[model samples]
Target: MRFSGESGNVTSGIPFGLASALSQAGSVLVAAPVMLDGADLISATFVRSLAGSLSLLLTVVLSTERKAQIRSMPMPIARQVFSSAVIGTGLGMTLQLYAPSGGPVGVVSALTATTPLVILPLIWFFGKAHPPGLAWVGAICAVAGVALIVNAG
Candidate 1:
C-alpha cells in the first residue's frame, strides 16, 4: 500500500476501501433481517435513499468547492450523474434487497460480487481503453471466489 501524503483522507487511502467494505458488509448484514422477516422492502429502500442523499447533501453543503463544482458541471455530465444515480441506486438497491429474500447471505453476496466482471465487458463494449491485465485477474479471482463460496455452502 502507498503512504498518504497529507492530501488523502477517508476517500483516498486503504482506509477508504476498508471502510467501504465494512459499510457494504453492514448493509448486507442488515438486509438479512429485512428479508428474513418479510419486512417492507420499499420502506427500507426509502430509508437508505434518504440517508444517502442527506449525507451527500451535507457533504456538498459543507464544502464550497464541491458546491461550486456541482453548480458549474456541464449539462451532459450532470445528466449522466443524475440518471445514473436514479437508475443505479433505484434498481441496484431494490434487487439487492431482494437477493437475500431467498438464500444464504454469503452465497448471495459472492454471486453479486461479480461487479468487476460486469464492468470489464462494459468497458470493452464502450470501446474505452482496455481494462488492465490486473483488472482481468481481479475479475477472474472474484468469479473464482464466488464459485468457491457457493460450492462450499
Candidate 2:
C-alpha cells in the first residue's frame, strides 16, 4: 500500500480503525446501562442532551475562530446548526434509545456498528444516488461479520 505522509503506513490504518471501533463500542456499552437504568427513556435523553449541549457550548465558547464565523453568519449558520441538531441530535438519540429496547445489548451494538451497510440505501433513498459494486461487497461483508461477532458472544 502506498504510504501517504499523513498516514505513515497501511498498518497505521488497522490500529486506527480498531481503536475507533473499540472506543465507539465502549462508549455505547457504557451509556446503554445508564439509559436503561433510568426511570424512563425521556429521563435518559434529558441527561444526555444536557451534557451534549453543555459540551458543545463549551467548545464553541472556547474557539475564537468559530466565534467570529458564528457572529458573521447568524441566520444561515443558525439554520444549518438547527438542521444538524434535529437530525443528528434529536433523531439519532431517539433511535439509539429504541435499539436497546428491541434487542440484547450485544446484538444492538453489533447492528449499530454495521452502519456502513445501511448507508448504501440511505444514500439512494435520500440522495437519489446508487453506490458502486465494491460498496455492495463491503456492505455484505460487514453484515456477515456483525452477525458472526454478535452471535459468537
Candidate 3:
C-alpha cells in the first residue's frame, strides 16, 4: 500500500523525526515495567493513552489560537486529521504496546531503528521518487546494524 506524507506533501524526514521523539518518550514509560518488574503493562498503557487524550482534549478546549487555526483550515483538514489518527494513534500505539522489552536495550533500540528503512521505501514507491545511491547504502547498513545488534543479544 502507498503511504501519504503529512499534509499530503512530499515525505520529509521531519515527520519521522517527530515520531521518533514521541516514540522514545512513550518507550521510556513502557520500559519502566520491564526494568522494574512491578507495573502491569495494561496499567502503563492506560496511563499513557489517558495522559495523551487528556492533553489533547485540554489543548483543544483551552487553546483558542490553535482552535482558530484549525477552524480556518480547509475542509480537507478533517481527512488529514483522521488519516493521521488512524495510522499514528491507532496502529502505531498497538505496535508499541506489543514490542517486547525483555531483551538487550541495544537490540530493542536497533530493531526500533528499522522504521525508516520500511518507511523510506514505501514513500519512494508511492511518490515515484528515487533517492540517491548513498541513501540505499545507508538503508542496507541500517538493516545490517540491526541484525548484528539482535544477534549479539
Candidate 4:
C-alpha cells in the first residue's frame, strides 16, 4: 500500500497497522486487570509511566545512537511526543477509570478507534495538510464502526 502527498510517501501500512493493533490489545490486557483489581487510576498511571521510562532507558542504553537522535530531534517531534504522552497515557488511562468494573473491554478499546477522527481535523487545521477525500471517508467510517461497537457493548 502507498499514500503520497505533502507528508511524503507511505509505502507500507501493514507493519504499523499490526503494531498499533497489538499495542491496543496489550493496553486492554493491562487495563482490564487493573480495573478488575480496583486499582486507583493514579497508581495505574504511575506504573505505566515507570514501565515506559524503564523501556526508554533500556533502549537508550542498548542503542549508541539513541541519545544523539533524541538530542537532535526537531522541536515539532518533541512536542508531538509530549502531547502523545499527555493525551494517550494520561487522559486515556484516566478515562478508563470510568469503565465499569468487569465490563466488556471492547467498549473501552473501541473508544480508542476514534483517534483518527480527532487526528484528521488536527492535521488539517494545525498541521495545515489537506488529506484526500478518501482519507476523510475512511476516518469517518472508522469512527462509525467504533461507535457501533461501543453501542453494541
Candidate 5:
C-alpha cells in the first residue's frame, strides 16, 4: 500500500486509509439511489461487482508485472483473498444493502469500521508480527473517527 514519489521515497497510507475512504464513498454512492428511489439491491450489487471484476481483469491484462505477481501469489494469500471476497464483499454487502441510511444503523456501520482496530491487538497479543506503534495509533484514530460522523440530530 506504499506509494513512491518521483524521487522513489515510499509514502505509506495506501492500504487502510485509502481503502477506507473509497469504501465509505462507494457505499454512499450506491446506497443513495437505493434508499431514495427504491432501486434494486441485487442489481446495484451486481453492477458494482461487474465493474470491479472488469477493473481487476483490465489491471491483470494490461500490466505484465501485476499479472506476474498475481500469478505467483501463494496459496495462503489466494485463500485470504477468496475468503475476503466471500465474507467482506458478498455477505457484508448483502447485509449493508438492507441497512437504512441513518438512525441506529449508522452506529452499527461505524462499529464495523473498527474491525482493523480490534484485529490489531489480537494479532499482537497472539505473538504475531509486532506492528508499528503508529499502526495501532492509526487504527485507534479510525475507530474514534466514528464520533465525528455520527449525528444525534
Candidate 6:
C-alpha cells in the first residue's frame, strides 16, 4: 500500500512490476515444457492447486492479522478468489492448451500482455473506475507493442 515516506508518495513501483513480470516469466518457462509434452491441462491444474495451497498455508503461518483481515472482508476476498479461479487458473489452463499447439512461448507471452486492454473495458463496464483517455491510449499502445513484437518474431 503505502510505499514511501510519511507523505506516502514518491515511491517507484518498478521493483514490484519487475518481480511480477519475472514471476510470470518463470511460470511460463516452467509450464512450457509440460505443455509441449502434451500434459498441459494436468500440469496447469496441478500447478495452480499447489500454488494456491502454498499461498494459503504461508498466509496462515506468517500473518494471522492478514487472515483476520481477509475474514473481515468476506465479499472482497470472495471476489478476489473467484476472479483468480476463473481468470488466473481457468484462463491459464486454456492458454496452455492452445499455446503450445499454436505457437512458441514468445508469441503466447506477448499476447498475454494484452490483459490490460481486456481489463480496461471490464473496469469501465463492471467496476466503478473510469480510466482516463491517456490510460486507454497507453493500453492500446502496449497491446500494439506486444503485437509488433510477436509479429516480428
Best candidate according to TM-score? 1
TM-score of 1: 0.78
**How many clashes (backbone atoms < 3 Å, residues ≥3 apart in a chain or on different chains) does model 5 have?**
0
Over 1-153, each residue of candidate 4 has an lDDT whose tens digit, in order, gives 223332434546567577667875686777787677778778877776666667668868887777888889999999999898888778776666556463677777777657657877887898777878988898888888887887873
What candidate 5 gets wrong by more than 4 Å, as runs, is 1-9, 12-23, 101-127
Q: lDDT by residue for model 1 over 1-153, one digit each (tens)?
A: 222224446345466457656777778888888778998888887777777677669868997987988999999989988997888777777788788978888877767667547868876676455766776888888788878889985
Q: lDDT ranking from best to worst?
A: 1, 4, 2, 6, 5, 3
The residue-by-residue lDDT of candidate 5 on 60-134, one tens digit each, is 798797788889999988998899787776666655655655435566567556666777777668645576778
Candidate 3 steric clashes = 0
Query: lDDT winner among the candidates?
Result: 1
TM-score of 6: 0.71
Off by over 4 Å in 6: 1-13, 52-68, 76-80, 132-134
lDDT of each: 0.75, 0.72, 0.65, 0.73, 0.66, 0.70
lDDT string, candidate 6, 4-93, tens digits: 223433335566567657766777777778777877486576775577567557847787876876678778779987797787767765
- If both were scored by lDDT, which would come out higher, candidate 2 or candidate 5? 2
Query: Which residue pairs of candidate 2 clash?
Result: none
Candidate 6, residue 123: lDDT: 74
Which ranges of candidate 4 are over 4 A from the true structure? 1-13, 50-69, 74-80, 100-103
* lDDT string, candidate 3, 56-141, tens digits: 67857886877987789787778877787667666664455556556544455566667768867765786587766777898999
Candidate 2 — what's its lDDT? 0.72
TM per candidate comes to 0.78, 0.56, 0.53, 0.69, 0.65, 0.71
In the range 3-116, model 2's lDDT, one tens digit per residue, is 122435656568757765886577568778776776366666666667668756886799797698678987966997789787876777667766776678788878777765
